[model samples]
Target: MNLWGRINTLRNQIFLGFMFVMVLVLAAVGLFNYEQVSVLLRSNAEKHIQQTAVQATGKLDVLLRQIDTFTAQVATNANIQRLLMQEADGRPINFEERQLLQQEVRKHEAYTTGIRSIELYTTEYRRLLPLADDTLESRVPDEWISRVDEGKGRLIWLGLDPRYPDVVIAIRHVRLIDRSFSHAGYVMVQIDKSYFELMNAESAADNDRAAREYMGLVDESGQIISSDFPSDIEAAALISRQETISLDGKKYFAVQKQSDTTGWKIIILTPVDYATEGIAVLRTAIIVSVMVGGLLFLILTFILSVMITRPILNLIKAMRNARFGTLKPIPVTSATMEINELNHTYNQMVVSLNELIEVVYQKEIIQSRTELKALQAQINPHFLFNTLEAFYWALDEKGEEELSEIVVAMSGLFRYVISRADEDEWVTVGDELEHAERYLKIMDMRMLDRLSWRIEADDASRCVPIPKLLIQPLVENAILHGVEQRVGQGTVVLRAEPSGRKGYTRIVVTDDGPGMNEDKIRELYAAMESGQNDSAKGNGIGLANVERRLRLYYEAGTNGLNIRSEEAKGTTIAFEIPGEQGRD
Candidate 1:
């Protein structure tokens, strides 16, 4: 072949094979560099956030513990202990003794000068000797005095300073143990919230000059306890939850630190951008290196003149014959006798191998279909046994009379779910509701007295068509997870109220069980959407499957399912399906 023809031939095979190989090399190097740089930056951001969270919390705890310890010690003091009992027993202190006790309280508060700003709350109850210019109105309310008297020592971290709104802070009440200490009412210590915010921000601000960061001390409720940006601070209080809150387009990695002294949580926020600043430079360098390397390889392939032969032309012709019709024995009558003979023999062997390959392909397809049916079969038997057990429970636990009513309802429900009668999609709402009631009866047997349920359906909604066996799975999830585990008695209410357009129906399902937190509920919905097995930890795949079927079968009826839940409270599951049914 001529030189230009040879170069053109290279384009016909795998895009000049060398360029294809070079692209793969470039992609691999780019991916490796991206991963390493990305991981290092993410790790640094995470560790710095964790470190600052632990440190700021540690200092805050030290400060809080100092107050608690001092308060407890003050409670046990001889004068205060005696005074508390006298007040509890309704006895008045003598004038000579009252003078000595007040002098001692003043001496003790001097030692706590660094820890708290002492404020005298009452004229009759007690006095902060040094801070007292004149007797002031009682800051310790009668309600607080009553709480201490009732023997409630639990100190809660109150979020808002009843008096101060702009300041981010926390507070707690300590019941003085001494008789006079109790009579003194309670002690109020003022803490500086800024001390914590400044200390926390310092550690995360270690790297780049322009990268900005914010520090927040939030309670377990996801409420900001001491943050300059109280509105921006998201609290993950009762549960140690963490989420990224983007502000002005910057990502802040927030870590939660729960305090031991007080039930407050300290969250430290750091800028993720600062940690990965070096990765951008590394990415550019890798791109440049790959381009230079690819050019060098193309030059080498051209110089080598890797074999171009007429012998391969005969081989290509044989390949075309095998594809176009029944495999033919290659021609051997050529001037190049040796090359033609080899091609003929190679063609004959390919005919035998191709026939064998066809046989294996057919067998594998049949086996795969069989295995799929077997998996479907597996789901039914477990379902059968579980159903039988539930019936047995209904009879024994709630009495035989309720059993007959449940059985008749369930028999009709099962007939519809298992039938192959309707090939045309779409079943009535009444049909889906019958299925849902059957599932609820099973759970009602288990919960017995603790279970109660209600279903409301408008006459208009019952005529609306829904995908077969849709509502049953969702009801099963609502009871099994929502109500069954709840401590107190539970209630599940399902409503099929008519909503939106004339033919549309809004179906809602809710339960009062041991509720789930926001994180867990989102996790529940996300897992179902992805078709993952969430059953291991109280997640059921049924709801997700039903959702997929609805979206696929019903072209544009409703957008999606809505799941809302709270921890130890309950959950609400709702979806809007058009009153008119099927995958239209």
Candidate 2:
């Protein structure tokens, strides 16, 4: 009421209208421009980073392929092959043969700058050849030797040599023909880790000197092979590949790519503030201009609103009194033509509204009485029972005992369903079981030998009170959707067990038919919990309605209905209700 009273005045209305329009225009124009500029800047930065990663990955791949080719040439050399063959015969490698093999290895070493050194070894013959000044390793690292043995003649990229962190080795296992291509030895080619460092240095030199972007290469095992970024910055990027992250209390934009050849991830982090410094300056200027323009416009609008609304202020005053009681005709005293016209229309509307009230009241009373009678007539049990009884006599007179029994059972079902119209809407457990049995009998006659059911109830649970029509629909759903859909016979079992909790009984309806999948079970349970009936997913009202009726009377924390199912297995539906167990 206080808010309405303040806004009802002409002065507050004019001030609010002008202020709203001025602020809305300023905010809309400033925010739209700012968003467009920011999106463009971020998109350009990401594209630049992705392109740089691709270029670096291509150069590294070319260098790796060249090294692989050189190792293959050394592995297939004639002198190396003859020595490996002679070593397989349990004979030692002669000094002259070793000299010829070293000459072949020297011939290949001069071909590429990427190769730092080369070594040859034989496990059975105990022969070693070294091409550099560094001493040959006492024994081949078992980790490297085992990997090469399993590589089946393919080159395996070893990221870093364990003994010498500065070296990266690409090794191949050599198999001699005399040994039936079995384990002879391995050929190791070592490349200085610094060989890849030059690539990063060249990339940095090619970019602008003022560029704030940092790039790095990381291998599959989370090792930084080459990077110009600080150690902490590189480690953080390797952990999470998000588009934006915080580093040293400042935000940065990050982009990453995985190399197809070497399986290494390339990451680039560019400081967001540095990249968009120009945008910040432009945004500040735009905000200042919008504020100035809004201030001038607000002043002019406020003056115009005051002049235009003075005459309507009197009309609003008269309308405010109309909320409490009947609206009488309003007097017109304004000099403006539109104000005089508005007062005349408002008076006519008041007179017509008074005349409409009595007629609408009379019609509503008639509608209420007629709807009540229609609902009562719809549930008349005598009408339904008489019709079923006539059908039963007709079937019996025609000597159709099976058909007569079904009609008799259906009559009992309708009688029980409608006879509780005046009762308290609760029935005993035995009463609900009788209704369910009648429904199952009708279904058994309809489905022939494909359906079977059993009901087991303890003597204590039979006398417990529950809502009417609780178990009938569940048994019906089990027969109709669960069993009838399959070719073979399906069985349904209804059991009432005493729950561990005091004053509660658990009832379960289980079926041995093809059951629902995970998605279907979830959809059914969701519909039940939300009290929505979705007809597309099998009889929405059947299970969901029963679940609601269970929850309406029972206590909370007890599931109204729970469904468990597996495809091609079966289904189980159960619920617990508040009831005493000792009564018989």
Candidate 3:
């Protein structure tokens, strides 16, 4: 069968409907749980990363404060201040003063672990301490001196000096701790970059090397002062408010905390995949469960559908046998109550069908006998024709020409009416018009000057086939009811021409006689629709018979006969006959 027919079967309907509903439920439950788990896991990951950022920032701030305190102690020392004052007076630094300043600088450097070196500079940018071998630049940058001045005794953090890119520097403007408290010199401290890596090491001690979180310190200018993931500094520094960001096409959650003392941001980047790894496992489990459950549902639904439709299939097989003239009844073998009821109804139907067959056979036999008797009683047309011919010759011998003509016409009309059997219903338009003319000729002869008639037709329309005797009845009605009732002479015209519709011919019979009123026309139409002979309406029976025969012979919806009349003007009756190509 076709697609619709296959889908319409009871087995497929039940199986598909059950599977559809099962899949919907499974999908809904799986999706709802997956989304809930995803949201909860992401929220927890964010909170955890945020706490890590805060802790890392706190540790770095503590280290920075300790370094600042150490630098402050060195800048405020009495020996360092007196030496700076003596240098400001343009006095040459003696061995004693230089030795005392060097001792003070060395003493403070030993107190801080990550400090590379400590140097003191005069107000004129001259170094006052002994030069260290690790120092890259002998002279302090003018930019550093200007920044120290801007600090006005407070510590100034200079992140990643180009002159010594391996270390971060902090500077302070030193002033005399004497009665005047005048400006003296500057103190600078260099801290090794390795000090920043300790934060990451402590935070990620439990994590594997591949999945460890990266921690970095960025200055206020978005420059990386120090970081374990230095290559990602540019991408990480751009993250401000977003919880997660993509770096080098891989997803990472970013959390940041700003230091209150140093004014730098401490950034922590954790990989998104590692944070949500458990959620991925949950998603996989949901998918596998749905697939396994769907397969089980499919198999169980198919089994149930087959069990439900088996009895119906058996009923269909029995019905098929009955359709092929087998009147045997179906046995009630199913345990289902509805199936048993259906089988019982089918058995009753088979019993009634056999009884109907018997009754139809008896009635057919009776009808055959009645038809045979009627045929035996029918008169022969040739016998009537010969008798009418004999009367015509007798009248001619008595010099009754008008009467002989009427007899000849009468014989032709009778022959035409009875010539065809029931099967031979169609006749050419020419033959039908000729038969109508013969009938009209007889009426004309009897009425004399009071009756006149004409026949107009084209050769094309005359050859077209129409139902036999369709034209003659109209002519008879026009004469008997119209012309006979008129006070003066009346005229009847018959015309055959192409109809307005393509492939059809119109034949109209018109009379110049007293016409019918609306009520009379309605009565005629009622009699025609009822297929009855109303003898009180003089010509209604003939017109009704013609209209009925036209409707039965022609295709349905064909305009059979149209009657148009005025009170005293006349009446016109017209109808169309299909052409050869138009007929069924």
- Candidate number achieving the greatest TM-score relative to the actual structure: 3
Which residue ranges in model 3 land beyond 4 Å of their true spot? Answer: 1-331, 336-342, 358-362, 397-399, 534-541, 581-584
Model 1 C-alpha lDDT per residue in residues 1-584, reported as the tens digit of each score = 46654544433443556676677667766666665675566665666667666767777877666666655555456775565455446565555555555665556666663433543233245453333444323443355445444544443334434455433322233345533233344444454455345353444455335576565566544556566443643354323454565656777665667777556666655666764466544656567656767666676556434433454665676567777755666664433444555677777687887887889999999999999997786556447646756786777676786775666566655566665434645778887786777777867876778888988997778888777777877777777787777776788888898776676788888898777887887787787789766543555547778778777876586776788777766888888876546444
Give the per-residue lDDT digits (tens) of candidate 2, residues 1-584.
36665445545556676677667667666766665676666655666666766776777778778887888888877778788877866787777777788899999888788677778877542545763233324444666567676788777776777767777778887776555777666788888876775245555665446455676767677777777776665564554857788767777777777766567777767677655545544665477656766767667777766666778788899878878787788776675556677889999999998888777889999999999998887766788889989999999999999999999988998878766545667778888898889888888888888888999999789888887888877777777667976779999998888888788888888887789999998888888788776443554347767877666666473677878988877788888877742211
Model 2: residue 9 alpha-carbon error in angstroms: 63
lDDT of each: 0.62, 0.74, 0.78
lDDT of 2 at 221: 71
- How would you encode candidate 3's per-residue C-alpha lDDT over 1-584 as one tens digit per residue? 46664445454656676777677657756766666676667776777788777778777977888888998899888778777877888896877787888888887777678988787777766676664332313545667667778778889887776677788888888888774667787788888887766365445675564576677888776777777674634733454788677777777888778888778888888888666656544766577667767766677768776777787888787678777765888665565556667888989989998999999999999999999999999998899999999999999999999899999999999988886465566778999999988999899988988999999999999999887788988888888778988997999999999999898899999998889899988888898888876443554448778888888877464677799998898999999877863443
Ranking by lDDT: 3, 2, 1
Which stretches of model 2 miss by more than 4 angstroms? Answer: 1-35, 123-127, 131-141, 176-183, 198-202, 206-208, 231-237, 246-250, 273-584
Q: Could you tell me which residue pairs clash in candidate 2?
A: none
Candidate 1 has what TM-score?
0.37
lDDT computed for candidate 1: 0.62
